[model samples]
Each structure stands twice: as C-alpha cells, then as structure tokens.
Target: MRTLTERRLRLVGVAAQRAHDRLGRYPASAEQILVDYQGTTRSLIAESLVDAWGNPVQLKAGTSFDALSLGADGAPGGEANNADILLSELLASSAPRPRSPEFAGLQRDLADALHLQFQLDGIDYSHAHWRNSDLSVEQIQAALAGKPIPPKRHGPENHGTEPGADVSRADRTDTEKAADALFGALSGDSMLAKAMGFMMKMLGASSQARAMIKIVLADTLVHADAILQAQPAPLAELMKVLTVDRNTQVIHDLRAIIADEPETRSVAVFYGAGHFFDLEKRICSELGYRHESTLWVPAITIDINETGMTAAQLKGFRALMRRTIEQQLKQLD
Candidate 1:
C-alpha cells in the first residue's frame, strides 16, 4: 500500500488532471470537501477507502453515490455518521445497534424498495440520485402509488440551476423527517432534519428540508484513530465495496429507473471524489460525465507512508470537518 505521503501526491495528480479535463484550467483553492461516505449506501469497500486516496478523486460526477447509513442501530440519527465508515477493521464486523430483527425487516424492505425502485426506473438510483434528484419528488409519489414515473432528468446543469443555491434542505417537510429518521440515523442536525422531512412527506405529510449552516466539532487524527482501535470489528467488507467498480450495477439501476419513471428522470448523486477513476480503461471514460471547479484546490504532496488516521484522529478529523463549518460561520465579520 502507498504511504500517506505518496497518497497525498497521487491525490494532487488526480485533482490536477480532473481540473484540466473539466474546466481546461487549474484549481485556485487548496482545500478539499471532506465528505464522501456520508448519506450513501456502501458495501464496505467504499467506507474504508474514504479519502484514503492519495489525492482528491473527482470533484463532481454525472452519477454519484450519496446516501446515509443509519446510526448504530442501522437507523439515521444525529451525532452519527450517515456512512458506515470506521478508521479500522474492528468496527466493521461488530453488529450495528439497530441490527435488531424487527428493524432489519423494515431495513431490508427499504433496501428492497430502493433496489427495486432503481431497477424499475432503469437508472442510477444511488441514494444520492434519489435524494438529490428532482426525480425523487415524483419517485416518492410514484413509489407510493406503485405507478410508472416519467423519464429521469438529465444532469442538474442541463436544468440551468444556480450553483450553490440549487439544493435547499428546507424543501423537505417535518413528516418527511420522521420517515427519513425511521429509515436511517442521519447525523448532523441538518441531515437528520432534512431526511426526516423528506421521508415524512413521501410517507404522507412531510416537513421541509432544513439547512443549518453550522457543524460544531473539533478533533485531531490521533483521537480518531483511537476510536477505531477501540472498536473491534473487521471492516474489510466495507472497504472492499468502496474500491470496486460499481458503475455497471449503477448503470443497470439507472436503466431500471428510466424504464419505470420515464417522465421525472431528474436525479443527482453526490459522493467522494475518489469513486471516479481516470485510470486508463476505467469507468469514468465509459460514463460520460464532466468535472467542473475541481482545479481550484491545490494538492498536498507528501511521501507515501502508512495511513495517518488513527481512531481518535479519524473521529477528530470528522469532528474537525464538522467544527470547521462552525468556525467559518463564526468568522462572518
């Protein structure tokens, strides 16, 4: 395996190439958005491989895998990660909190619902697609009604939406929030609230999606690694899922979505940049997606060493990622 330093350098290269391809320009910023595993379903591989890339994977994608893993109970909750990623293997094998037989049925049902929904639509139904897509609106209704939907929407840009303001959490309603919370434990006030609202609406009367600007946290890698070390489940399964090429499955699902919902085909998925591999003969070439605004971030080059994230550190980093958001908010001078 490459050392953390080498990985950083590689990450730099990936970012550079992606930037060139997307904007035909270079990045103007050095900071990378730290979210990858949150709000997305993963097999195991994707979780362990989060940000493990030496460089930023890809800034954007036409199809993304954004979904939230329910909290320890396998249900959504605040103060818990939406993705099942842990710093080490131990936590992986350990049973999740809600792995209860009762909830498992519903969980499986939802998964089945999601799987079949995607299969029916004949399109990429990564949770991100469902949550982010305009198709999701119709998807909820159609899924409830057991009726066919219209065509999926093209990539968001084709719709001509303003960049930052495009997605607002407030769109979800309160009932949706409960349903979403019922589905999975979405940490972070905003994520939990948003999921709850949307779910409520879909199930019946949902609340509007909420966007809370502050993520209060401050952690270092050391602390993160410790937390991982203490948890004793092998996370190999999750890791394997992340590294594998899932586009074919994604494609199959996307096609299914299209077949079922031909009218409201609009969907969007957001996930870690690493999923898009520029490697020769990789999925990216096969999947015609473009990257924009990838170039602005500068790559951090370092010699390859072992991964630097300890349990405490990983937690700390996550905390930092969250807290940093708060810091920025505090800086509104």
Candidate 2:
C-alpha cells in the first residue's frame, strides 16, 4: 500500500524512467527526449510538469547522480541551484546520460571530497547527521507558549504527537529525561545511523525536508558549533539537548535547512532508509527512484542494526551503504 507521498515521488521517477526507457528504444539523451516532450528548454522542463503542490518540477539532470537535486524553490532557482552542490551534468552512467568532458573535473572534485568525508577520522560516519529535526513552526511556537505542539507524524519516542508539533521534547525515549544518553549506546557508526534513521522514521518529516538534507550534507565540512552559533536563542539550547554538536552536526543541519528556506515553497524529503509507512503524495511527486526497471518512490527504510560497523563489520557496512547509495543513484538516474 503506497501512501500519497510515495505515489507523488513516483512521478519524478516515472518521468525520469520514461525518459530513460525512451532512450533505449527511441534514442536521444534524457534531456533531449524530455525537451521534445515538454517543448521547453532543458533548463525549464522540470518547471513544466508541476507537482501536487502545483509547483513545477525542477531536476538537476544526470545519468548516475552523485546527488539528484530539486533546488530550494523546488521550482528552478534558489539556494540549491546556486549552491556549489550540483554544478554540472553528471555524465557517468551505464546508460546514455549526456556524457561530456567539461563535467569530468567537477565530478572528480566532488567524488574526491565525498570519498574524503567518508574516510575522515572521528567523523561519526553514521548515516545520522547532527541536523536538528524540523518542528513545525506552529508546533514549536505552541509548545513554547505552553500550548500543545501539533500532533506530528512522530514515532513512539514522541508518542504520536501532532504533525510538526510546536512543542518541547516529549518524555519518551528509554529515559525519564533526555540528558543525552546517546543512541545505540553500545553501537557503531552503522548502528548509530540506523538508530537516527529509526528515530526520524517514527517521525514524519516537514516540507522543509530539503533543509534537513542540507545539514546532513554539511557534515562533509561545516562545523557543528558554527551552525549552532548561526542560529539564535532557545533554539540553540533545544539543538544542544538533541546532541547535535559537531559530532552529529550534519544531521541537525539537514533538518534546520528545511525551515531555513521556507519561502521557496513546497519540498519533499527522503530519509536514507524506509522509515515511514504513510507519507503524503505531494512530496514523493517531485523526487523518486527506479526498481526492477519499474520506477517507484517508496518511503526509505533505514537499517537499525546494520552489519560491518565495527572493525569486524566494516566491510559489511561499507558494502551495505554502497548498495544503498548505488540504489539511490540508480533511482536518480
């Protein structure tokens, strides 16, 4: 049973797949085919096929994406489009996807940075980042005002609060008080990432999901203290309680990034693993992946107990993550 969100995400995957499949049968690059179909410039095609939010879709096209992007506006322009993230066409592919040498150096640079980040010592290396999960502005404000945070799509840790509850941390978890006991107490990087993923899945994400992704990506370089310093007030204290310091900064940033760019309009977010049982269709519409030659966008499931995290399990976790990324890349492809 696919939720509306999953169905929507399938739109992007379907569109991409249609374009990809056409290439094998009819010919022409994915961009060319789409341009012909939409009768628009490659740059503007994404904006033509609007999502449920009624916003035009904007894609950062490539064959095998290092990362598939929908930009901040979820339309065409904004921080994401301008960010140094997706600078050029991702030409690498098993299928024909606009191969060009100009993007080669850019690809190498990104790959190198990504590889380094993956190898960085004491990098936490878990899928979980230091990003602060987004609390709906209304929900947080209500909680601050001593009102109920909205019932959010939260997990058991949250005890089923309103979607985007504007509230303080609930007395859930394994503790009577969340004094930073740390997740996966007796775990490694893979387990930690999975734990974080589990936490997120139990909670549905915000449209600011893109913002959250940004924070996770930031872990590649940006300092945690730096991000906290950037934010103001009690929010900082709240972030601290979440244990999103430099050690877990990336994850926190990703969540914060969502609310950071709200003016951009509707956006969809995807966690690394299948966590949600029911997410909206609007989000799934703009972004997605492919499976068994059929395109689909289902809630990603995180691995709570991943193998190869410890010294004895390194090889296994590495392979697991690689397979996940590889699958993601193909979806974006």
Candidate 3:
C-alpha cells in the first residue's frame, strides 16, 4: 500500500502542474500552490501536505522544482521508506501539457450550454454563467479589500442587460458571511457536530470520493440549468440559500427601476439558473406577468463518445452521481 508520504508527494506534483498550467509558471512556494489551484468544488488544505511521520514537507524551485518529505527520522537520507521522498522523481514523467483542441471544444460546449434565456412579460432574462475561474487575482484581491470591482463581461452571446442597467442580484460578502456561519455551526464543540465534520473531511479527502464529487458537481451545475428550463423541484434546497433572498432584493430593485425609469419598458434580471424558478414565480404571481416564450441553450454537453467509457460504465457512473447529489441535498436539509 502507498504510504501517506507517497500520496502527499503525488498531490503536490499534481497541484504544481495545475498551477503552472494556469499561471504560466510553477508556484514559488508550497503554500501558494494550493491557493492558486483551488477550485470552486475542491480545496487542498495545507495540513494535508505533511509527511507520514508528521513533518512539514520542504518545497523548493530552482533548475527543477522539488518537494522533499524528509522521512521518519526527519533527517536527510535514510533506508527504505525512511529515505527522503523526492517529488522530482514523480514529476519527471508528469510534466504539464496544454489541453488538446478537442478538450477545449468540449469546455466551450459546456460553457455554451450553461447560458440559458427566458422571455417573460416582453422582457428577456438570461442566466449568466459565472465560475470562480472568471475572477482574476486582482479582482479577488479587490473584493477582499472591500473595493468595488468592475462587472464581469460575459461576452457578446450572454444577451444580458447593459452593464449600468443591470440590477445586482446578490451580495458576495453576505454569501461569504453565511457560509462562514454555516461552517462554524457544523464544526461546533458538540460531539455529534465534530463527528459529522470529521466524516465530511474524510469523504472530501478520499481520492475516489473527490473524483466522484467533481463529476457530481459538474452534473449538478448543468442539471440545475436544465431543471430551471424544465422543472426546478430538485433544486429547491439550493435555490433557498442561493437565490430566494437575493432574488427578492432583485425584485425590489426592479420595482424601483420600473417606477422611476418610465422609459425602460423592458427589463432583464440576469442571474444564475438556480434563481430562475423563484424569479419566475415572483414575476408571474406577484408582478402580474406571464411567460411569453422560453429558449433552451446547451450549457454543457458530456459526449459519451469522446469519454471512451462503455455504456454500462457510463450508466453506473451516472447512477453514482445521482446518489451523491441526493446525499448532499439531504445533508443540506
């Protein structure tokens, strides 16, 4: 069986490669590597990089970058697994490579599918696709500093409202605060809470579980969009936190905009698909509006042909994904 030191070395190599791919250079420090490559759904905790014997791994970059797990003795050289674990050895055959054109096309297809549109009461509303990757380092820093960042340009095909005309739907700061509170509640001093927290960490750290989680999160994001177009019942819990309160604020903004700006005959409230169901209900029932037309845009397409997986395998994978999402939703409840 692979030792903890071996697994951590592999993780460091993978994270370094990913950071290199994104930033055009390898991370200068081990701590920064995790920060740079952190995804919306996955995060690499600093403590996880420690060696099997509970020593901090030393990371350096020179002619070639290397991470050293100074073995059980916490000394330089020793015998067997006690020998220093050189990450360079693992990275030798694992250099970073640019994504293929086919892979880029698949990502574009996925992005295109994520953008959806709806026409209600003679106004066009589009679900804007926003991923954590869309924020630049400068923008993120500015946000942290409490400075207003410029609106993200969603490209010409977004078909959303004009920059100045668009009403803000949600406050990122509020969302962050809510998340902090929830995390604190989950990790409280209570024994049951601690056990639940431990289980969550264990599941998150498992390689198989992490891989399955990535697939499920991807599916949930796309499925959320599709559900918004068809029926959004499955997304009830997600919508409650993500959209309802924020969308209510949006409706209030719309009310003021309509009353103050008489010239504005049509208005668009651009938001994520998770918000659409609630928005639609509010507009039709409260605002005396009705849906005139609907447009379905492909946001993400998982081409089984390109995946090289058998039909049965794909079916089983999808079953696992559904169960994962269901379990997550239950936990949220």
Candidate 4:
C-alpha cells in the first residue's frame, strides 16, 4: 500500500502534467496547477497544500514541472524518511533531462590534483555525488538572455557599503583608491562586463562570488596579462573555493546523519575529488571515524598530450591559470 505522502506526490505529478498538457507549458506556481488541473476551488488556500511532514511543497517550472517535498526533517537532502520526494520521479516520462554541458576535463584534472582516494577502513561506504538543482535547456537559455540575473535566495543583502565602496576617501593612498576605482568600473555596462555577468549566471554562480571574479578578471586580463603568462597555476585557489566551499552543506548533511542515526553503518560520501580531503578530515577528526580503504573509479578518461594543442600553447594555458589563482589569493589576503 502507498503511504499518504507517496500518494500525495503521485497526485501532484498527475496535476502538474495535466496543467502542462492544458497550458502547453508548466504552471509557474503550485497553486496554478492545483486550481487549473486538479479542480481545486480558487478560494482554496495555497499554504494548506503541504506534504505529510507539514512542509509546503516547492515547485519549479521548466520544460516540465518539479514538485519537491523536503521530507520528514524538512531539510534540503536526506536519506530514508527524510529523503526528498520529487513529483517528477513519480512521472518520469513527463520529466525532461537537463542539457548542461559535462565538465569532464575539469573534473578529471581536479581529481588528479586532489589525489582523490576512495577507501574508508572498517566501514562499508556507498558513493553519491552532490549536484546542483536540475535546470532544463529552456531555463539555461532564459538565463543567458542577458537580463539581470536575479539575486540568490537567502543571499546577503546589499547595504551599499560593499567592498571598494570607500575608494575615494582622502585617507586612502592614491594607488589604493585607483585599485578600488578599477574594481568599481569593472561592474559597469561595458560589453566585456556584460558578457562576464551572463556567463556567471549561466553557471549558477553566487552574486557575491561572481562580483569578485569580475574584479579579478578585470585586474588580471586587462592590465597584467603578461604576468599571468609567466605563472603556471593561475586560478587554482578560486577553483578550490568554487569547487569545495560550494559543497559545505553536503558535509553538514553527512555529519547530521551519522549523529542522528547510530545504526547508519557503512556510510558512503561520494562527492567530487576536490571535496574528499576536507570531508575526510571532518569525518575522522570530528566524527571519530577512520580511513579504511578506497576504490578508484575513472569518471572521465583524457590525455592532454593527445589533444592537438602545441606544447607552447599548453604551457601558456597553465601559466595563465596560475596567474589567475594568484590574483584570487591576493583578494583573500
């Protein structure tokens, strides 16, 4: 027999598909689907439509609809009863796959650099990768339409006192003020700036981090290209933050599971190679776990030497990346 929650998820999937069939597009809001397709009275309160866990379901519209219940704990991701319930999973035929380009090369390189090991001693581990929310091809295209990207939900508020805002103060050195001015100007309406902004949004970058990347790009690409040409590990630090910090929540979730359920033997944290080092430290030192064993799985296979690029070209690319990394580190300092 289907549980009440499972039955509700089935109903949501049916209603979402019906709304899509009628309107030729997914409804923008859950209430719209409920009213138009499920025959719910317009006077029905939207908030009343919640899962068995009493959390309001989240709805996202794309080429198809996604209705999500955060599950028993009402958090983003979990296992067992707390695992997310997705309406699209119930109606897999009506769901569309995301069309984002695979970052196989980047993944491979980062994996090697991090020296990712797959073993944990005395524990049976399962593997799972952390991923961003699904976005359809249509959603990606819409985001790249050059419109101002919406600020991230739950992101920090802008109070006008953001970094570089005090560039013109008399107490500041001329060079310091000039640097600040340059950073500010990079955020202007120039074509290059606009293009950078668009690309950042397409990658689902946070607004604050995107702004920093723009400043670094402006400072390095515009003025110090030769210096970057001399470096071999450009952008390494920035890449670390982009790849590692973004998955902090995954670590938190793992810790929560271990703490809450003592019987959760043989836990598997299958994340990107970049994430394993920090996660290992947390798991062992903080959680009283020890490294046991690892299994190496090739996520991608590639040989840089096989690529048609000349030796000089490859060296130059590495140098440029190094310089980019150095500049990002400076900003942190």
Q: How many clashes does the backbone of model 1 have?
A: 125
Please identify which of the two predictions, 1 or 4, would achieve the higher lDDT against the true structure: 4
Instruction: For candidate 1, write residues 1-333 as lDDT tens digits.
Output: 223323333444344345454565544333322222122222222332224322222223222212122223343344533233221222235343332232233333333322222122223435432543233343333322324544554554243223443233665444343434444542213565456445533532211111011111113322332332342222222222322323333554545566688886454444433333422224245445344223234222221122244556545756667566455435532
TM-score of each: 0.20, 0.23, 0.34, 0.28
Superposed model 4: Cα runs more than 4 Å off: 1-96, 99-194, 197-256, 270-274, 294-307, 310-333
Q: Rank all candidate structures by their TM-score, best first, as comma-separated numbers.
A: 3, 4, 2, 1
lDDT for each candidate structure: 0.35, 0.36, 0.55, 0.50
Displacement of the residue 13 alpha carbon in candidate 1, Å? 33
lDDT of 3 by residue, 200-302 (tens): 4565554455444445557777556434334333333323444565566567667777789898776756676766878899988878888765533333334
- Alpha-carbon runs more than 4 Å astray in model 1: 1-234, 242-248, 255-266, 270-283, 294-333
Error of 4 at 144 (Å): 26
